[model samples]
Target chain A: MSAADAIAVAGVTKVFGSGNGQVAAVDDITVSIRKNEFFTLLGPSGCGKTTLLRLIAGFEFPTSGAIWLDGADVSDTPPFRRPINTVFQNYALFPHMTVEENIGFGLKMLNRPKAEIAERVAAMLKLVRMEALAGRRTNQISGGQQQRVALARALAPAPKVLLLDEPLSALDYKLRKEMQIELKRLQAETGITFIFVTHDQEEALTMSDRIAVMAAGRILQVGSPREVYDAPADRFVAGFIGESNLLPGTVERVSGGLASVTLSVGGRIEAVAPDGFSGGGPATVVLRPEHARLMPAAGAPEGAIAGTLATAVYFGTDTHYHVRLADGSDFTVREQNRPSVEARFHAGDAVAAVVEPRAARLLRERP
Target chain B: MARPFDVRRQRGFTVVAAFCFALLYLPIVVLVTYAFNAGESIANWEGVSLRWFVAAAGNAQVIDASIRSLQIATAAALIATTAATLAALATTRTAPYRGQAATFAALNLPLMVPEIVTAVALLIVFARIKMATGYTGLGYLIAAHTAFCIPFAYLPIRARLDGMDLNLERAAADLYATPVRAFRHVTLPLLWPGILAGFMLAFVISLDDVVITEFVKSGGQETLPTYMLGQLRRVITPEMNAISTAFLALSIVVVTVFFLVSRKRD
Candidate 1:
């Protein structure tokens, strides 16, 4: 509730049921969203991503906590009174009205002059690239057209924030990718804060300025896509945001803010702990697929461990290899499919997986 | 892949469908055609004439009764349809709550009970009121029609409300309209088709009702159906057929107009 922040949710908790049956859909979440940043809540299914969006939209109320918007406490304000709009996954266009009429409906309710409403509606249609379809009924238009109209309708009001709940989910794979870019562009042009919710990690990484990776009704970590991926706060964040090789281990020694850990698979590894830990304790090591280097031949070199290439999947731009260590644990390594590395390794080939001491992160071992 | 054109072989099924339609409509067809007969006995059909039609048109009591029925049906349809629309909106747009099922059952009770039962119940209530103050207005007929027509209006309107997209309303709210404004602008306009269809259906049903009207109506409160019943007891003439044919034409016109408007919306 200041010039910098458009919306702030403080200690918001949303519980679904009561007594013996209760679900904390959003548990004590507190976050301040900036004026015009495209913030996203990214998580898998049942992670309360959509629930948090609905809470911000005023469709659902917090069990205990306050939501402030533009310096006003709107915790108890109904959705219609709040200065926010939501674009649903299913573009819920009014079937009875043509695109022009549906878009002009809000202006009409404000008792705006008929000419003014028509002009604004026309401008909006042009903005959304749907001017040609203005006269057509909603059912007559395609899904993407309807989606554009829905965006036009929500944006026409020029609300302070636009809450999108998986608006691109209904589109096909190709359209989803296209609209992801379009949505970011639209957010940039409008300068309205967009609180987008999705279970898609790639969409979040591609579109959001900052992403909050959530799980089990709590935000496990919040940061830029690169920050969260490269330096995960916990094991869940590392596993949820992208593909990573998580190895269970215990610290053997701590020296100069770095720890040498021995894995359950009987492999010794050294990793940097930016957050210095107590010497000789339980911990886990996380290495991103891209961080591990694959070298031909058995037996580790100076800073490497021996493993066999159990499987190699050749993606278009990158080849991912599942490396099975001598002690029977398997981890994945992705190498760029460059011409130089094309014929480097194959399945069943003995290889040495190498990593820099700084590339590996010491995460808390999950019980 | 299997060919999509395999459905063409099923075209022969229309023959049986046509026979079934004929069986269903044969009696109404006979009734309608016989209304044009000029014979003294309906079975004879000696010739065709417009005399009975003219008589039906000029009958003052019949015309007044028809006007009264129209007025009551129109008023009842309006009231019932509006209440049903609000009820439908509440059921759909609001958050889930307790007591919603009990409210639903209460509103729909009249539809589930037999017409005779409702008629008797209304009669008793009206009789008690009449005995207390003798202040019976035409309001009784309006009340009865509205009660009977609510469920009819509710079902269709609720279907439309259930299928309605909340996105438009949310968009409207974000645009700065209050909740009431959103309902008026976005929700109501979208719901008009269903409301109109439901109202017209209720109007037709109310106009043709006999049992409840007979139970509650006082002297000098004859509706068209009750008047027609009285005419039947006294005489069975081509005049009745003429009246029946006119009513049938009117119903057809109403239904056709509704469908035409609804089709344009689609």
Candidate 2:
């Protein structure tokens, strides 16, 4: 483990139940979270993201492997002894405690002096901008206020790391957006390593400095948000991060760091092959909908794949055209809504979907 | 104001409810009224007076029995509530084990069995034990009451624990509370209302229990309810009504206090 790594989870595996009913909740996994980085574990439900967070929080003891915090093996350390705190998904604020009391509880547990606790709690309340509601009980506050209180309480201890388990999932869209910025600001101000867990791709992309995309108790890929979204490691990661048009094909040629793959849809497209490509092996070309452009087939450039528009979906910011390619595979091309009325393509319009070679990624097919 | 339902339908429902209330409360009202009757005969009210109340208060046996009953109920409620709380925590908080269903069934057995059967079974066991050791005291009554009251106490405690979000306890631990501290600070405070409710329910059940107390108590260890039964078997008087009224009042006060306490500041 590096000196700057705040947490290092090495080969951790957690299995639940026994015999035929046994299931691995967290398979053998290793990841080093750096100090003061906004790292995220992103996956759908049952993908073990929450379980990994819980394991780090010391809520669950791993069946094997070690968890290192600040260069010390804290695998067996109880949650209270760890220099970490969690903001629960439901914002589990103590219903009986006022916002101030809730925020001060950790300091009290740490045996801090009453005066220091008060000052710290006041500072936290101010940080979350909840000073006015500090005296209100948890149940008396709104959902957003309660979320702020939860954050304040977890942050008041000034732990080395803060774990958030989809803390913004319960908030409305507007509130979630606001808190996303607020959380980023808080992370910067506190300079605490944050391990945020969320299934929301947008939230992860917006807030995290780096993200680990997990599925089925395994880490599929780990990279910065931009790297993971633009150059995913596998079909799962590619599909999970955002909307993508995966064109299945067999590798036709490889040169330098790029490969030409003969698309199953009767086209040959050049893409960046992350792993060196071999001839005659199945591969998939991942094209983000926004990267593919819809153009009239009559005047289309070379390397443009011909297709007939199947549907036109008008999203306020952009229009998406679902085009059926020659080989019966469908791909969607999104275009920003232009001010000109004549730029729109209708269903059944013959068009060529063109994607730049640099924008497409070639990945090996999963067995 | 206009009625939501037809007048006839409302009247019918009111009549049925009133009839049920009368069925439930009229006998108790009559008994209470006769406790203050000036006449010796409980059936005939000559005028209202506190003569029976005075007699009941002055009776040594009634007083002793009341004190004994209070002691038994308090002891039984404490033991039962503690045991029930532990049982609830184990069954609800822990992961499922092989015999979890059986354990639940065992806890509920006392409630499922007939009271008379339980009383007899306890009597036979106590009789054997007493013959072996010659130890007979209020302990037997307390033990029997505690056994019978566990299920009553367990249900509400379990429900409360189940209704509680486990996340709060996790949050407590994350906030630097140890397991024990988390239980003390988070679990216990949140569970107080259920525990208090369980205690009051157990206390009332033990206080009002007659069959179990009769079978379990040794000589001169009669609880108030068993003592009242003995008194009624021999002679029916306004004093009996007075004792019953006082017992009812005590139970109401306990329940009302519990209600108020649980409802406060939530």
Candidate 3:
């Protein structure tokens, strides 16, 4: 591990139960989280993201492999001995304690002087904008206030790393959005390495400096938000990150760092193939909805695929057109709502979907 | 709003409730009243006086039995509550394992089985131990009472642990509290009411227990209830009534304090 690495999980595997009933909650996984970076583990429920966070928090021990924190092996270290803290999904604020007491608990456990603990708790409560509620018990506060208290309590000790497990999942949409910005601001201010776990793709994209997209006990790909969203590693990652139009095709020709694929829908399209492509092999062309443009069939570009607009969904900011091609495959193309009336397309309208070669990716088909 | 039931039906319900209360408490009221009887006979109360109460208080055997009962109850309650708390934490906090159902059943066996059977079984075990070691004292009573009260203490504690959010304990650990410290600060504080309730229940149960105390006690280690039973077998007197009234008063105070402590807070 590098000096810059805050947490390094190497070949960690956590299995629950035993014998025939044993199931691997976190399969063998390795990832190094850098210091002072907002890293996220993103996946759907049962995808082992939370389990990975728990393993790092030392609430769980791996079946095998080591967890390194700040270049020290802490695989067998108890949670209290580790220089890490967690903001639980439900906040889990101590109902019996005042917010100030909750935030100061760690410092007290560490045997800090009473004066220093009081000062630190005051600073933490101020950081989370929970100064007014500091004297109140957790149950007396609102959910959002309790969330702030949980964050304050976890961050008060200024641990080397902070782990958040879907901490915003309980909030309403508006509050979640507000806290997202607040959390990012806090991370920037604190400069503590954050390892956030969540299933929400938007949350991961909005907050993470780097993301590891996991599914079924394995990390599919580790990259920045834009990298995973634009160039996913596989069909699963492609479908998971965001909306995409995956057109099944056969590679017709490979030239100039790009591959021309003969669409199953009786058309030809070009896509940038990072890996050298072989002619006549089955491939999937990942076309993001926003990358495709809807045009009139009569004056459409020569390489554009033709289809009938099956449905038009108005989403205020953009209009999503579900188009059915000649070969029965469907693709959704999102068009921004223009001021002009002619830019809109009705259902059953003849349309051609145009995708730029550089905006599309050609990936090998997985069996 | 129109009435859903007739006034007669409502009055009939009230009458039934009053009858049940009378059946439950009238005998106790009479006993308490007779404790203050000025006369020697319990049945013939000449006037209300504190003579019997004073006599019962001054009686050396009564005082000794009461002190012995208090000692046994306190010791048993402490032992039972401690064991119950540990058992509760084990059952509720840990991941489920094989034999968990069996463990639960075993913990509750004392409550489910007839008291006479447990009393007899304990007597046999204690007798065997006495025959081997030739040691007999209030230790056997304390042991028997603790065993019987374990379920009483375990139930409330387990319920509290079950209702608790496990995440709070996890959060405490995450905040750098060792397992012991986490229990001290978070789990124990949240479970305080339940623990207090369990202790009080066990104390009351141990204090009033007759069959178990009777079977388990050595010759000179008669607890208050066992001594009262012995007196009743010989003859009924206003002194017995006075002692019973005092026991009842003590129980009521404990139960009332328990309810106050365990009442829900905002």
Tell me the DockQ of each model, to 2 decimals. Answer: 0.52, 0.80, 0.75
Number of the top lDDT candidate: 2
- Give the alpha carbon lDDT tens digit for every residue of B174-224 in model 1: 666787777776788778889998899899989999999999998899999
Q: Judged by TM-score, which candidate is best?
A: 2
Tell me the spans in candidate 1 whose CA falls farther than 4 Å from its real position.
A1-3, A101-126, A339-344, A365-367, B1-20
The C-alpha stretches of model 3 lying farther than 4 A from their native spots are A278-280, A339-343, B1-12, B40-45, B263-266
Per-residue accuracy of model 3 over A189-233 as CA lDDT, tens digit each:
999999999999999999999999999999989999999988888
Write candidate 3's Cα lDDT for B87-165 as tens digits.
9999999989889999999999889899999989998999999999998877888899999999999999999889999
- What is the Å distance of residue A165 in model 2 from its true position? 0.5
| Isolated chain A TM-score, each model | 0.93, 0.97, 0.97
Candidates 2 and 3: which is better by TM-score?
2
**lDDT (Cα, 0-100) at B177 in candidate 3:** 85
Ten-residue segment with the worst summed lDDT in candidate 1 chain A?
A: A297-306
TM-score, candidate number 2 = 0.96
lDDT tens readout by residue for model 1, A71-153: 89999988877778778788667777789977876566667899888888888898888988889998998888888988887
